[model samples]
Target: MKLHYEVDGEEFAAAGQASGNIKKMLKQLGIASDVIRKISIAVYEAEINMVIHADGGTVDVDIQTDKIYIALKDTGPGIPNIDLAMREGYSTASDEVRDLGFGAGMGLPNIQKNSDFLKITSAVGVGTTVEIEVNL
Candidate 1:
């Protein structure tokens, strides 16, 4: 099965909508609780990142018998340095974003921790794409 969602940028209140829906679907499909938990956390973090950083973005999820694949793409300012961004406390979120109690720089790290495989690609002046895979 394949699922797609469009994340609205700067919409903090709506940040987890996609992840919530995914979680519900996973539960209905009888996915393991632990697997559902991991996917929910990873997707929520990615979704929050889109709302907080990117102007907006798209999330695509593909579910198969052996694995689940998730891809998040945004046209916002790309990460200048993937290595730096991967640091636990490194964040470029604006003060306004911080005021909302989000953006602690743990998004990517959490995503990495939850996924079996992860890949991120970005261009300085263009955008970013994050691909995550979780083995079943």
Candidate 2:
């Protein structure tokens, strides 16, 4: 199975649309609850990041018999310090966003925690791409 989604930038109301759809699809397919949980969490965090930091992006999901692969690509300003970005409780979100209680700086960390494998590539002036793998 394959799924593709485009996240809208700075759209808090629609942040979880992709993740919610993926969750519904997984449920309808009778996927393992634990696996579904992990995917939802990872996808949600990635999706939110796309809207909050990346100014929107695309997510591609490939579901295989033994594992699942997800890729998120963004065209926003690339991550300046991956290490800092990965750190828990570290954020560059504006006060306006913080007021809405969205940015706790745990997006990437949460994705890493939920996926079996995680990879991220970014350029200062280019963009960012995140890939994730989950075992069945």
Candidate 3:
């Protein structure tokens, strides 16, 4: 199965909509709870990152019998320093965003921890694309 979503960066309230939908689909498909949990967390964190930093993005999911693949792409200012961005507490979120109690800088790390495989490609002046896979 394949799923696609458009994340809206302008609306914080809509951030998790895609993730939530995916969770529901997983449940209805009778997917294992633990697998569903991991996918949910990964997607949610990626969604939040897109909203908080990427300005907006696209989420694509491919589910198969033995593995699941996810791709998130954004046209926002790409990470200038991926190594630093991977740090658990490093974040570039604005004060206004932080005031909302979001942007703890744990998103990417958490996504990596949950997925079986992960890759991130970014261009400082262009955009970013994150791909993650989980084995069944």
Q: Cα deviation of 92 in candidate 3 (Å)? A: 0.9
Residue 130 miss distance in model 3 (angstroms): 0.9
* lDDT tens readout by residue for model 3, 1-115: 8999999888889889988998888788788889999989998898888888888899999988888888999998999999899999988888998898877888899999999
The clash tally of candidate 3 reads 0
* Per-candidate local distance difference test: 0.89, 0.88, 0.89
Candidate 1: worst 10 consecutive residues by lDDT?
A: 7-16
Error of 1 at 97 (Å): 1.6
- What lDDT does model 3 reach? 0.89
- Steric overlap count per candidate: 0, 0, 0
What does candidate 1's lDDT look like per residue over 44-107, in tens digits? 8988887888877999999888888989999988998999999998889888888988778898
